[model samples]
Every structure is written in C-alpha cells, then in structure tokens.
Target: MSERASVPKEAEETESEPEQEPVTTGAQSVIRALENAGTDYVFGVQGGAIMPVYDALYDSDINHVTMAHEQGASHAADAYGVVTGDPGVCFATSGPGATNLVTGIADANMDSDPVIALTGQVPTEFVGNDAFQETDTVGITQPITKESYFAADSDTVGDDVSEAFALADAGRQGPTLVDLPKDVTQGETEVEPGRPETPETYEVPEEADDEDVQEAVEALAEADRPVILSGGGVIKANASSALREFAKEYEIPVITTMPGIGSFPEDHELSLEWAGMHGTGYANMAISNTDCMLAIGTRFDDRLTGGVDSFAPDAEVIHVDIDPAEISKNVYADYPLIGDARNVLRQLFDAMPRAPDADEWRDQCQTWKDEYPMDYDTPDDEPLKPQYVVEQFSEMTPDDTIVCTGVGQHQMWASQFWEYTEPRTWVSSHGLGTMGYGVPAAIGAKLAAPDQEVVCFDGDGSFLMTVQGLSVAVREQLDITYVVLNNEAVGMVRQWQDGFYEGRRMASEYPWIPQFDKLAEAFGARGFTLESYDNVEETIQEARDYDGPSVIDAHIDPGENVFPMVPSGGDNGLFALNEDQLDMI
Candidate 1:
C-alpha cells in the first residue's frame, strides 16, 4: 500500500469532543488550533480589527513575522508552504489590509500552493453598515480561494480554523481564508482547550486502472520517439527519482515546464531542459517531432502548448494527473490515468517491459542540442549582459542553493541559464506572473531552509514592486543574496512593445532610479553596485560573504532582449531569434 493509503481514515476527519470545557475567547481558540495544525510561523501586520488575535499570539510559541505590506506577508506564507510542503499561515486586518493580500492570494491560488489566510472583519452589528475598515472579504476572496469562511460565533472558531487547514491541504491544494469579526474574537464561549482533530493523512490511489496502464505502456513500447513532459506536480509529489528512473528505463527524453524546472536534473543525459515560450530550441524540437508523449502533473497551459491545434499534432498523448478535470481540458489524451504522480509512476515502472534501443532518436536529439545550443555573447565593455551575469552567478553559487525569481526578463534568463539539479530548489511566480514576488519568496525560502543559500534574481521594475520586503530580511537577520538586474526599464514589456506595438515605449523606461546600494544601507543591510562585467564574480563573492542580507545592483544593457522566444499564439517552430541566435543555429 502507498503511504497515503496506509493512514487511518478516522484521522482525516474533524476531531470531536466528548464534553464542553471552560470558557475561552475566540482569539485564543484560533491560536490553539493553529498550533495543533503544526504551524510554526505566522506572517502579517497588526491592525485594529485583529488586535485581539495579536494579543493572543503574543503568548503563543508561533513566531510572527510582521511584513511591510500584507502582500509581502501573503507571498511569504505562500512560499513557506512551497518549500516545506506545509500549509503556510498569514493574518491581515480589515479593509485595506485584507484587500492588499488579494494579489498574493491569487498567486497562490493559480500556482496551487497551500496557504491559510486569516482576516479580521467589522463587528457583527456593523457588517452591512460600511463601518470604518469594513469590507466584504468573503465576497472578494470567494473566487480565488479553495474555501472561505465567516466566523459567526465564537464557539465555531476552532472548528472553522481546523476545517480551513484541512481544505488548504486537501486534493488540488490552494489558498483558504477565514474572516473573523471583532466581536467573535473578543467573545467568550465554552470550548475544549485541546487541539482540533484533523485527518492525519489523505489517501491517493496506489495504481492507475489496469486497462489504462496497459494502453499507455503499449503506446510507449510501439513509439519510435517518446517523450515525458513533467510539470510542478512531480516536485509537489516528491517524484523526481521515480520520473528519472522511468525515463531511463524507457530511454525517453524528459522536458519540463517553467514551474517544473528542477523536476529532473538538467545535466542528466535524458533531460532536454524546459519546453515552452522561452524553452530550449532542442526541447521544443522534441515536442514538435515526438510520436508519443507521456505528460505528468501538467495542465498543458497555452504557454507550453503554443497553439493547441498544432501542438504535437501526430503524437499520441497519455496524461496522468490527480485531477480528472484536466484530462482533456486542453489537448485530448488517448490514455488518461488519474492518481498521484508518485504512485502512478511506481505502478507504471512495475508494469513496463525491457527498455528500447533508440540510438537513432538519441543521436537526432543530440544533433539538435549541438546545432542550436542556448548561447549569448558578453562584450568586454561597460554595460553588462544579464545572461552572462546569471551564468557566472550560477557557476559561483553552490549546487544546493535555492533560486527565486520575479516575473519578466530576468525570470526568463534565470530559467534559461541556471542548471537546476535538485527538486524544490527553483521557486518563482508562474501562472499569474506577479512582479515583486522574488524578495518575499527568498525570505520565506531562507526561513524554511536556514542552512541553504537563497538568491533572488529580480528585474529592476519587479524588484521595486515589493522592495519593501527588504525590511523583513533585515528584521529577521536572514542571509539572502538579492541580485537586481538594473536595466532601467520594464524589459519584458519593452520587448513586447518593440515587437508587436511598433516600438511605442510608453512609461516603460525609468528616467530617475534610486541607488539600491544607498537604499540597502538605509535598511541596515549591506549593498554593492557593479557597472562593469569584469567585477561580476568578485562582487558576488563579497556579497555572499556578508553576514546578513545583502543586495547587489548590477547595471545591465538596457537594450538587451531575451532571444529564442516563441511569439505569442504561434507554434513552436515560429521562433523569434536574433542575429546572434541565428548564427548559433
């Protein structure tokens, strides 16, 4: 039996008490329930409506991290869950505070990160009166959250919180919210002081249907060129080893999505790197030419499948995912296996026959890799190339380092240049592509893995979006490296404007930029400025050697653009490569 199935069923249900105990406030019950749920940290800022809960938290063991913005807190909590595989917790006050968390909550929802958010509401009497700092949080968050709750009574505080955690960690995990009114938090009720009962485990199928497994196996066995397309689910399921073993047993090439960057070792023989908008030329070629495809844990988003009509037009697709709704939502799957990725892969491995000899196919792929290798040139001059800087940083950083990136040009460059060899080492804002995700996410990653080095590769525009998060790093004394690619413009937007909008640059360029080094000093953190490509290595080394949080502002070429990009709504073959990339190909 799989580990998930081995857990007792009773442990999955809400705990029930035999008798009511002494009177306790709703705020106290919330803190007690969170402790029972195994939450070690709570990220948020104190406010008027939520003061009682903060008072209760003062006596609890959970470490509270006060962020500069509620958005930062939400992102931090979401990233904590991504790294630890636990439901991250966050708190916010009423009105603006709760509204500020919307972006991060949506981010977690889109990425399927497990998060529990708690917000304060106006007193019950004034709920519909539009009182001071009152907003309909439940209505605002209903669309984005897995579940939303409004605490009507003090007695249900523990039950509501316990249920929220249960839902946040349940199937197709995402964010959950609880809105507690001021009266509810202050009200006293007869409740048990013990922890609420929650399910100890969730059961997933040990194996897929026998018929489906056999069909998939037959398809793979008969195909001349087969490929495995992995997504974030593999990392979430802790199935990298299983994925690698299955690929080797079948002599299949593995291509990952952006969120799935570290799902397979990029340096491995079977690894074809990422396949999507900014993916490797060879990986996209494999996608275009494969005869059979086995997709795991991916929804086949439009970005990955450039044109749904032409994506792998001739290939037979076999999709295995935990959610059945995703089976034929995009590309039709000839064989659909619905179960946990790890368990399904294990069963597939057991049912597979001897590995096939695809020497010709392997050679073809190698030829593609050699002919159109991902490359860039760095001139020995003043303004540095962001790609070259990232490449050098990737070489200097330890293998176990965790890299987090904000959305935009820098994110694409980091995804292209960094070779991720381990699972859960690369975290980023996908789906929503939110700017300002890098700094807070790095702080959360460092909190989850104190011994591992964490770096945030951020573009100037993205960095400034959540630059306030630097205060959290200084306050927590977290050792993180913030490398700002200072291009003085919204590079990705400008690239689009240049390509599609006839180079009408409107509000994309920054005429006056703050000196990041001085800003770091203002935050009581170390900082460095690098203008020349020659100083890249030594400056990074110095920042890494710093005891506390450090920010490195590297001025890069403002005109440099990411190449080998697939034009939006175009097929994989229609690549927008520059002159240098064309020469390499």
Candidate 2:
C-alpha cells in the first residue's frame, strides 16, 4: 500500500483550490488609481526614486512616453491638458527632477490649465536628512499648485494620488501634485483604489447669480459699443460654441486674449482676433474704445490692459469667471458674474430682454480691421519672413491642424498669421511664456489628437532650449512638422534691446547656430533647409507630407520684430505698428 500510494495530498489540494490573487504593492495601487480614472497616457522621465512606480507601470496598459528631460515631460503633459481639457499627468523623481517641473507647473497655474504631477520623494525616514535625491517637493510646489500633498502612508497613497488627479481638473482647473516617498510606495498594500473624486468640500459654480446675470445683460444691452473679451478660460471650459452663439445673437464684436486665440474663429465677421501687446492693432483698438466690455474668463493681465487707466477707459466691465478671486483682481468689474463660462453664457442668453443695437459698432470694428491688416512683406532680395512661412503653412494645412509655438518672436508671428477657427487648436505657454515649449508641445498635441495634423513654430534660441524634445518625437515616430525660424539670435530680446537699450546687443545675438535641419537628420527625422524662395513651398510640403517628425530650418530675417506693440504701461489703442512708431508711446 505504501508503494502504490505515492501521490502527495498537497498536489491534489492545489489542483482543487482556487487561484490566489497576486500581491498588490503601494505603487501598484497608485497605477490602479490612474487606470480607474481612465488615464490613457503619462509623460515622464525615469529616475531611481521613482523606480518602483515605473515597475508598476510595466504591467499597466497606460502608455508612458519617456522624455529626454523632465522639463520636456512637463511641457508635453501641459499641452496634453490644453488639448484634451483633462488633467494631463506627468512623473518625475525627487530633487532635480522635481525642480525641473516647477516651470511647467507654474505655467499651468498661471494659464489655468489642468495638469497632475506625481513626484517621488526620498524614503520618509530620510526626508529631512538630505538623503540622495531627496527633495521637499510638496513645499516647493505648493504655491504653484492648486493643491499639493505628501503621501504619509502606503495604505492611503493611492487615495492621495486620486485626490490630486481629481483636484487638478476641478474648479478653475490648475496644476495639482502628490509627493510619494520611496518607502511609502514600496510598502505592501492590498487596498484597491476607487474612482477619482474631489473632496466633498470642493464645489464649482454651475451658473452665475440671476441678479448678476441680469445686471450684466442690462449693461451689455445699454452699451453703444460692446466688445466681448474672450480669454483662455472659454476654451478650457469648452464654451467656444456658446460664446460664438451669444456674440452672434447680440452682434457684439469678439476680441481674444493671446491664450484665447482659438475660442472664436479668427475669420468670423464679429472676430476682432486677439488684443494685447503685439496683438492685432484692430483688436487692441476695439478693446480700448468699447463703451461696455464683457470680459469672459480674462484676468485682464498687464499685457492685455497695458495702462489700466487707458484700457477700455469709457467701458463698464462685466467680468465672467469661474474663480471669484479673479473677478476684480486686476480690472474693476462693474458687474461680476462668477460661474462656468458655458453656463453663464447660457444664462445670459436666456435672461436677455432683447439683442443690443450693435450693427453700427460692428461696422466700426470692421473698419478697424481693414485699416490695420496683419500683412508682412517678403522682398525676394531679403531673407524669408517668418510670417510668410506661417501663412503658407496655415494655407497648406487643414483648418483643424493644431499649431504649437515656443515663446519668442516666432510665437507672436504664428499667433498673428495663423487663422484658428476651433478651440484647442492653438497650444502654447501663454502665462509662463516658456521658451522651449514648441517641440515638446507638438509631441503632446499630436498624441492627444492623433488624427489632427500638428505644426510647431519655434525660433532659433527658443528651439535650442529644448531641442532634445525632437528626440522624443523621433523615437515615438510622431507626425509633426517643426518649422524653425532661425534668426541666429534670441529674437524677442534682440528686438527689445534694439528698441529700448540703445542697440547694444549684449547676450541676445548668436554668431553661430547649428543647422536645425541637419540636427533633425542626426535625430533620425526628415530635415529640410529653406534658404531661399526656390524651395519654400517644396520644402514645407515635403516636411508636412512626411509620415514621421520633420524639422525645417527656415532662415528668417534677423532684424524682424513683432509689431502692433503696446509699450508696457502704454495705451492699448495706441499700439505701435513699427519701431519708428514706438516714439508715440
């Protein structure tokens, strides 16, 4: 009997027993939280402190785009936020990696873009000891973030992350952060994370007070000349269509802030384009002279208001915003309507007694547009004008193409020349004005909307700041056209120096620059050089037609400057169209 019955009882027990669940770590719970929130993509730079989280990401279905630098990852996430109207997620390790994300976080805060940043911290025990790669991420980012948290325990780390994710997209929508200690993330945990949800204390205003809406409507109705100043918040709230309908029904002219470029169709009859320093002359004039201004989601930053005393001097301002804090922070709001843009607009439409008599005002706005047209000259003898390149590309691409830009003269040119007809099509660092945003932003925009074509306009110095982003695009095989307006200098700084610093071009101009096209080729992308008109169309077409990333080194006039400028503290109506006209201020 002993020889015949050799089978172990353990084997039979194992076969009959149910399979046990795999052990879940704190890091796995964090990933599960994001998955529970339906996150499809994450942009990040890997480091030792965050290794556990990266390991967790391995088995998850979320697509993680590894970037060459933490700064690029942050910008990419910011752009993703702009395009999707969701909280774009970014990851970084402690110390330098976390510090690198500061600029992007600040940018998102200023622009009111939704972004979630997950930063790794040194083990909880080593936090104050200055351990390797240690950083006080929560402390550093608190001012810039809508809310920042330190994950104190492994059991609640996932909820901390989930809360951050929800908070980033709630209320006025800004950046949020969660600092995960290494030990906390490595600790064992089996608690499953629930769906992302903001705390009960968090509440967004759905509509404006009825009395305030009525007052705003009355002011607009009584206005002889009313202009609607649409800001980035309109697009962020997905209120573009509502804004358009309201403006059309009332026959009021629409003026966009730089970040509001795509909130209203640029070519529409009531469109005044954008208004600010270096904005369209007509838009600025309209903002300056309006008798009543209905400012939607605009904070009336110094750039937009110029000399506050002179901006809309005769106008009674009706400010509509989701965040009440912004109602009268910069500009006095005669009528404050605090609510979501779309909801408020709908309320205004329903409450209006009748449409205002704005036909005459509309005619006046049209007159301004005809008088101050956005046109640039391109003499065959001179080097190519970047504006021409922008215009040509705009004409060649579909209207839905997404345009991204770095901060500089090229950015102003792209904003000035490209006609945006839809929301979420123009992605740029509006509030922070980050120099190296273009290449990385294009990558993000393309990823966010894979079906839409993407174009990045960057200047030589600006492009040089984060050109490594091109490597990410190349590696990912993203379809994007990067047009570098190589002027061999920090064009904006040079222009400012030339105009205000007695022409002493101190650190602004660069004598030598790498041919960006060749650099693109080195990065395994299609490259083209546009030194003359002979290859302008051919080069751009070929670059746009390329299936993967492409860079065009389009040599532009070194002396070119962004005009229609309102000198700091100058009147918006008195924008300088050229360097010679600057004296008027």
Candidate 3:
C-alpha cells in the first residue's frame, strides 16, 4: 500500500482519539484550590473578564453569593473572616469592579482582617495594552493588601491562590490579593485533584525570655495604678479569654480601643469599656493617669494616643505585639515584648505574682466610672433619641446577636451603648471608617452564623450608601434587622462642623431625605417607620419576629452628638460633655 494510504485506520483513530478531558483549567484549579482550602462561601459579582472563573464556581461545592456591588461583596467577605476566624474570600472583575473593592479592602487592611481578594485581569496580551476592563490589580492593591500575587500562566493559578490564602491567614492577618488573567482562566492544564502543599505554620512563641518577663512583672509590681490597654489584636488572636484571665489575675483595669469593644466583656467589673476618642471619660482618665500601662496588641495609633506627647506621660509602658514594627512606631515603649497576644499574655500571667493591693486606685477608677457612666436622657416629647433606641435594641436582642454598624455617629453610639459580651459579635469598619459597610457586613455575619440574629445599626447617610444591599438580603431571605437612625444628615461631619467650623453646615446636611421604610418596601423587605419612641420596643419585637429582612427607620434627634468625646489630637482631659451632664462627672 502507498505509505500515505497505508496509515492504519486504527492508528488514525488512535491519533484522533478525543483528548482526555482536561484534568483542570486555570478557573477549575482556582475553585478546586479554594475548596481544598476549606472555603465555605465566596461573596462576589460576575463580569466579563471573570466569567470563566464564575463558570467554574457554578460547578463547585462552595456557596457563592452575588452582591449588589463589589464593595458590598468585599465588606461581606471582610465580616465573614472576622466572624469565622478564617480568611473570607471575595472575587471581582477587572477595572471598576476591582476599584470598587478598594475601600472594603482598605478597611480589612486597617483592621487586620484576613480577607482573600481575587480579581480578574484582561488577557496577558492585553495586561499592559490598556484593553477594556484591564487594570493592574496587583499594583492597585499593593498598599492595602498584606501580599499581592499575579498569575501570569495557567500553571500558577492553584499555587497563587493557595499562597494568597496562606498569607491572608498567617501572622498579623490582613487582606491578600491574587490577580488572574482571562486567558489563564480559559487555559487548560493537568492539575492534581488535591490540596496544595500546606503552607508553613506560624506559631506564637510560647515563652518569653525570663529577663523580659521579669522586667514586665517588675514594672507591674512597682506601679500602684496599673492598667491593661487592649486592642483589636486581642480579638484577632482569639485571646479574649486569655486577656480576661490576665486582667483578673493582675486585678488590673482593662480599657479597649473602639475596634476592641467586645474583646473584654463590658459588664466585667474590671472592664473600663473603650478608651481614646469617644471613649468613656473614666477609661480615658485611667489611661491618662495610670502609673503603669501594659498595652497588648495595640499600635497606640494617634486615635488612642490622642496627643502622643501627653499620652500616658506618667506611666511606664510595656507594649506587646506580634509585629515588631508596631512596637514603638507611634508611642515609645519602656519595655517591648514581641510575641502573639495570647501566648505572651499566658506567659506573662504565669510569670507574674498576684497583683499587689491597689484598692485605692481601683476605687478611684470605679468612682470615675460611676460619675461619668454612659447616660443619655430623652424628654417624653422630644424626638426619639438614637441612644435610647440602641439601648432598647441591645436589651431586646439575643445576647449573642451580632451587631454591625456603618460609620459616623451611629457607630460611636453603638460602641458606647451596646453591651458586647462576646468577641466577633461587634463588627464595623474601624480604621477606614467606611460608610455603607454595616448592611453587607451583617449579611456576611448572618451567613457565617446562620442561626444567629444579625442586626445592623446604620445612619441615614450610611444606610443610603449601600441601601441596594437590601435586594440581596431579600433575595437570600436573610433574617436581618436593619435599624436606620435617621437624622437626615451626615451626623458625624455635621458634629465636627458645628464644633470646629463655626457651625458652617456646608455639605454635611442632606438636601433630600428618602423614606427608608418605603425604600425597604421597594426592595421587597418588611418596613416600619418609628417617628416616636412610644412603640420602639414593640416595633423591634415585630421586626425580630418577621421571618425575613426588615428595615426600621427610627427618627432620632438631629442635634444629638456622641459625648465624652476627646477632641482629635487633644488630651483625654479635654472631653466635651453635654452641658447638663458635665456637672455629674
């Protein structure tokens, strides 16, 4: 037979045999990697460049939630991580989708939350060519993310995603990003159907040098008025129990930062609640007057320090944290211990003797707490007070209900009024102070603990920022109670304008006020408008009993401001209290 014709039909069939189904594509690898990493949920929105990954997601076991906006998805992911103590996963398409996530990513970064952000990029050929929907995600997220990765080839998809998760959940947890090109996602490759090699484990040192422990112990022993200043790190490290035990062992008063509100039980006898700007007068007073201050996991940011030169001027400071860079970056530490909060606290507790008698100091702090106890009174005829509403809500909600807040006056009020008995129950954008974070974060919190009630305390301005999230909540049928404290203004900015800008309202006031109840109804959620405080409790109960999402628009005092406020950069002693309440303190 002629050589060309002699090719066996069987040989031709063998050569043309359909190629084995690809073991994996870049997209499939990404999804499988996440599944291997134990990711239960992913919050994101689909788009052109990311369609391939979304297609892969459709077949995966992971639960995917499509949010109204990328920012909402990011915040939702942020809360998921905060509540679960795992890296929350978020995906976004290129360009505007990626850019919209910046604020939420920055929020995670500032607060040290472990969030994994995955963004789609244009094909490799178009990466630098300014193609449609193309942007340098790695470059854009560099400053905000703990680490950033770009998967230039299909082979790196799994490795890059695995590394991003590892980095996000590792020491000093923060957001991490992985950028995947469209072509890569569409490319086929043979990938093992198993988890990647486990990343190196980070263990907090169990023991501190004897001398360092002695130094800290001696500092505590010598000081009559000792205080423990806790921060978000306590919660992040899952060391709230350790912190409480340490405080009890030392009989030291514990004051937390705003982000650390629930780190220590507010109802604890030793608890000084929160300190720094908008902190209780007593907590700030204790920080300013302590003879020895042991700050753990706190960066002592300008907010906490107020006037750095004047902060804890009289106190000998012992700062402990995992990151050495934060040890003395802002406030100088007399003794710096670099280690994990839980591990270090455990060691310190074991090393130290029982705290010396400091009854007089303790009593003095108690007196301050009594004198300036958080209080707000509302006249029967006066418009409903936001503080009262929060107090009632706090009282009525389940003890473990997760409370999330949008930024501004409502945030400070929630921090002050709500009694957070558990860690991770209080969620908010502390560092970035991003508005419109509450609703979506609450959604994430609800998803994290489906049985737990998730309530969002949002302001009029803040609720408007992400009101569209209501549609998602309704679609998912999440039983979330959103309380809008409607003052019809950017209350916090207006407060500042009133206090510092000679009452120039400027752009702080909202020209048009949308009926939040109507808006909620339009979004297919139950709605209630409370113009009076007479039935506040009843309304809350009704909303709580409702089987799905509900919005309660409670008209609050427009002029009310957060009290015991220390002017920015001003000493704690410069607290501005209501005129009528000043004498009580």
Best by TM-score: 2
192-279: candidate 2 lDDT, tens digit per residue: 7766789999999989999989988988898889999999989877899899999888888999999999899998988989999989
The local distance difference test score of each candidate is 0.85, 0.89, 0.86
The full ranking of all candidates by lDDT, starting with the best, is: 2, 3, 1
For candidate 1, write residues 135-227 as lDDT tens digits. 999999999998889999898887788888877876667899999999998999767434433345645454579889988888887888888
Model 3 lDDT on a 0 to 1 scale: 0.86
Q: Over the stretch 1-585, how does candidate 3's per-residue lDDT look in tens digits?
A: 010111332453345333323447999888877866778899999998889999998877789999999999999999998887788999999999999889999999999998999998899988788899888889989999988888887877878898888778767889999898999989988874444333566454444566887899888977889999989888888788899888987788999988787788888899999998889989999988999988988888777778898898899999888887897899888988888888888888888876856788999999999888899888987788999988999999777788999999999898889898888888999888999999999999899888788999999999999999999999999999999999999999998887778789999998899999998999999999998877999999999999999999998989998897777888876676773443332
Give the TM-scores of the predictions, in the order they appear. 0.93, 0.96, 0.94
Model 3 segments beyond 4 Å from truth?
1-22, 193-207, 579-585
Indicate the residue-level lDDT of 61 in model 3: 72
Please tell me which model should have the higher lDDT, number 1 or number 3: 3
Model 3 poorest 10 in a row by lDDT: 1-10
Q: Please estimate how well model 2 matches the true structure, expressed as its whole-model Cα lDDT.
A: 0.89
lDDT score at residue 368, model 1, on the 0-100 scale: 82
Shift in Å, residue 225, candidate 3: 0.4
lDDT of 1 at 313: 78
Clashes of 2: 0
Q: Of the candidates shown, which would achieve the greatest lDDT relative to the real structure?
A: 2
